[model samples]
Target chain A: MDKVGLEKHTSKQFDADLEDVRELVLAMGGLVEQQIADAVRALITGEGALGEEVVQGDTEVNRMEVEIDEECTRILARRAPQAGDLRLIIAVAKTITDLERIGDEAEKIGRMSTHLASYDRPKSAFYQIEMLGRHVREMLRDALDAFARLDSEAALRVAQQDEDVDREYEGIVRQCITYMMEDPRTIRHMLDVLWAVKALERIGDHSTNISEYVVYFVEGKDVRHIGLEAMEKEINEGAARRRGD
Target chain B: MDKVGLEKHTSKQFDADLEDVRELVLAMGGLVEQQIADAVRALITGEGALGEEVVQGDTEVNRMEVEIDEECTRILARRAPQAGDLRLIIAVAKTITDLERIGDEAEKIGRMSTHLASYDRPKSAFYQIEMLGRHVREMLRDALDAFARLDSEAALRVAQQDEDVDREYEGIVRQCITYMMEDPRTIRHMLDVLWAVKALERIGDHSTNISEYVVYFVEGKDVRHIGLEAMEKEINEGAARRRGD
Candidate 1:
């Protein structure tokens, strides 16, 4: 909000840089999110080749992360932007780190997928786990869109969606335990499911992180550590509520 | 290394402010590290009351994080520290965020321990998990010390030790699966151990983050996303040994 020195410049350069950074960030987010989806799909479908592809795809995400970092540094050094522009660059840097870690987690999931493909005995319930993966991927895309648009309301919505993914994770864990108890043969398969579920839950968390950064960049407020339920309750009570009953 | 504007007395004020920020960050690190240890102890010893204590202790960590943020903001507003001091503040701010999250994760583990204590289930064989917790705790403490001292050597050592903790975590997961298969009733207990072990592994990750920050703050080199095993190997193959072996 504090334009300071930035106001003197024509709006074209400012908008262009902002658009460029957002485009790069969203592109990075898309790749990382797809990687997560493919990684989980490889697990459920027993596609070892797909799993290997997800693992290899992480290199591109990592490379993009470095390029984004360099771009951010260059912007800061050259323009010396203040306040909102500063926050935007900072958010881009931090969110890219989160996105890269999401890529790493996705790669880990892919390796687990490869291992699960090799297991002689497979867990019977793959559909539910894939649903959970879809839930996480949707949340990630929503969070990334919210960040690019600087939509605080959209960001809060994504944060609310995290709880659903969390519940799905809990359900998967319970089901895995149930499966392992029914027969000892399901041990390795269930364990791999557990790891995969954990990775998806972590992806939800990172998406929430990107949302938090969005709120910070847009509003200049740190809303972290606040209880999500309380936040939703406040939003529902406030004029921000749109459709949900 | 480039002190671009050190001719004026304002630079001295910035340096002093940076020193204060560093001191506060170290203090916060000490408190968070203690919270981690206390949480692990509560889990291992089944100290429900201590678990409650650990959860309550997180408020202090949160307060310290806010204080650190305010201090950084004030320094940026007043002195506008450039180069190394600017990087140091940013690194400290990022480190505290990770540390606070570590505290929150530890609190979650504590809460899980309390839940485990309430359930009438067979106890898990947490020997490997306990070792993993110890390794993570030491890595965290050492990494913070390295940050405070700006000792890349010490940070590298802590980074190298993370692999040991990770290996121990794998061992615990395997052991948990073995227990769950031997008796279906052990599934709940095994899940508890799994959650705790995962928390410890995340703690190890945060230590790695702190070490990376040390590398950045000391060397001004972002060694993040580099292969940890390769870095450890390079570090361990000492200067003299590098020529011969």
Candidate 2:
């Protein structure tokens, strides 16, 4: 083949490899999102069986993470991709780690849900947990979607959503404190609620992490270790530049 | 210059670059270790000023993380290092991330210490936190030492230590629950302790992550997503095989 033919072949192969990584990542994200939703439902409905399913489902997420990581390493070793391609590989690798941890957090919630199912619960605390869970699940969904689309604007929106989740989490913690203070008998069950909310809060954090990776992948910038306000400003400026283009 | 001389020069340059990255990582590790120590001291002593210093020190850790990451990327792009060199770079990049997160967790403990300083004391709770914090700090130190020496065995030892930290964390949580149940007024103060222990537990996790990276760098294996029992078994088998040689 001529020089152009060989160049085209190499580029095509790199594209195909990247596409494979993306598909695997999306599949893992979809599984994790379901795990979060099912875990929350199990918590609210007091269904231990569904919670068990979420816990069992985590093994698959873990497997997907390992597979995706291996693929990224293989590409990096074989192709020695540079610039945008290197950034994408790094982002995908880091994103899967976050996804796997999200799955683990969901599994923790599932376990807590199973434990809580055996106890007589507080109605208001359960309601707050359900609401917080819904918010975090939405954030995860949006973060994954932004990653799939390479949409920094959508990613920034998801990052901003974390503050709302944090607020809701604080509210739940305060309510749990009140419940425990009013009736010591409820302390044991309230502890479970507290732990579940902590897991939900962590899920929100992992989602924000995913959004940060999306920004990094798209812009090749490291926005981490900076304040949220600075991150938001950077994302907004990137969006404006895209519009100007 | 001849081809042989050029190859020799390139190898020397690569070694120098690797050494530089390693030195930066160790320096960052030292800063993080100090942060953890200071944060724990502040938590136990109820010195808000020390906590503020730890929080402020996180900026330096963050800057180091970014600089190290950029250096890794530059080396990858310019050197196209392979095999062990490639794995070492990847491990350093990933390890620095976990170290930065450990710093963030320390900063969180610092902030909680600042807040809890304003509250009335729970003597026994503080004691338990102190014990747990010391264990986790030791684990961080061992993990960093393992990385610096490229000692996979030491890394495995550090990974094993995380279980003890987890058990200690659970004990602290249980004590906090009991305190909250016994005295309604102490519930608020106890919650602060709970969050700090939670942060400490997370720091242990990040420490485990660094250890796993050490194992990966040495053995070229992925031991994560697997249970600790399995990881220990793998490391032991590897050790046994080495002995047979």
Candidate 3:
């Protein structure tokens, strides 16, 4: 429930700069989340134009990343941010990189959707993909919420969803491979589906990365590469101490 | 011809810290490069043991990334570095992320190699994978060299190799799809090879990121997502102006 304390700085402009950058990140995240949903919907519904739109929108995403990066560097140079502010800047840098990558993956899915548009919709696998897409979109949303609120506990919860997404991805891949074996004619379409699914799995990973950054920004800990249980334990222990305080 | 100019710092300890970090990044790069080679070799040669070793060694790579990250953060906090020093710290942070990702790709290749070991060596596609692996490995090595020497020009050259790697990867994927159609019995093995090749392609991408980081470090320009030719033009213009200087 702790929000990022934006009003602590004596310099109101510094607080405004941080707030503006934060809003920009959330806007970027919202756009990326929509892209993932649209790309997945395009794939399932065989909407080629929607897919193309998603691809075109990626340029905007790239532009935002560059703009935000420059803003961060400017803040760093002018402010020489320390302590929590420095961690916030670093975390913002890492978060935007993951968001931009999520945009790229969504664009890939969009391309795959256009290709899949030419083929008959494979109902069963497409359903699984839709489900996976929904899972990751929620994960993305919740991670951004955690970031906005400085909710390390919520971020930890979001991080755990990654395992479920990964398992679902594997099951889908196995099913798709089985389809390829049974019907040789479906190889091209199935492979496209597999690639699209792979992109979804990677989106899940980037979501996990964003949540980790939330923890890093809030807790001032580098929780990357650590296993889920350990991350959870560390976050929970920190929460206990904070509650005691 | 330009080094990172570590000697510019007023504090001798700050200069020494920068030099130490630079060396640490190079050492990490060296380990990652070897991991890529061993992983690819294990895939091509069906050395499951070697693949396992590569997979196990990833923890060490992850450890290096974490250690280097802490060091960079410490330097940033302590030095409050300005201009080139700030850029160097930021670029180092970004570079370690890419290198860590390259290591992750290598580990995935290792896993795929272990999976691919059960089947007979499919010579043709495996050769393509090997060549593609070597191509990316070179890109990575050249990128690290660019970082060490602050050679933006060399970095641009390394960036160009990514396209060739991408083309080769596509060629391999297409050929593998043909193989899967010709013989469904080879589906599992061919898919494993395809995944490994995908890993190789991603390694190329990470290499390109590193090269871009080098360019950023040397020229103080954000050249990413700008396309290969545009990046070259910008770097060339920088070099041209520097020559006049």
Candidate with the greatest TM-score versus the true structure: 3
- Candidate 3 lDDT over residue span A84-175, tens digit each: 89888899999999999999999999999999887887689889999999999999999999999989989999999999999999999999
True contacts kept of each: 0.46, 0.63, 0.69
List CA RMSD, all candidates: 5.1, 5.1, 1.4
DockQ values per model: 0.46, 0.63, 0.78
For model 2 chain A, the run of ten residues with the poorest summed lDDT: A1-10
How are the candidates ranked when ordered by lDDT, highest leading? 3, 2, 1
Off by over 4 Å in 2: A1-10, A236-245, B1-10, B240-244
Report the lDDT tens digits of candidate 1 across residue range A189-234.
7787788788889999988988878766766666666777655554
Error of 1 at A80 (Å): 3.4
How well is each residue in B11-67 modelled by candidate 2, as lDDT tens digits?
777888888998999999999999999999999988999999999999999999999
lDDT (C-alpha) at residue B155 in model 1: 85
Query: Tens digits of per-residue lDDT for model 3 on B150-242?
Result: 999899999888878989998999999999999998888888888899999999999999999999988889999999888988888888877
Q: DockQ of candidate 1?
A: 0.46
Model 1 over residues B80-140: C-alpha lDDT tens digits?
Answer: 5556666676678778878888888898888878877655533445556667778888898
Q: Which candidate model has the greater DockQ, 2 or 3?
A: 3
| Candidate 3 clash figure, as a count | 0
Off by over 4 Å in 3: A1-7, B1-7
TM-score winner, 1 or 2: 2
Best by DockQ: 3
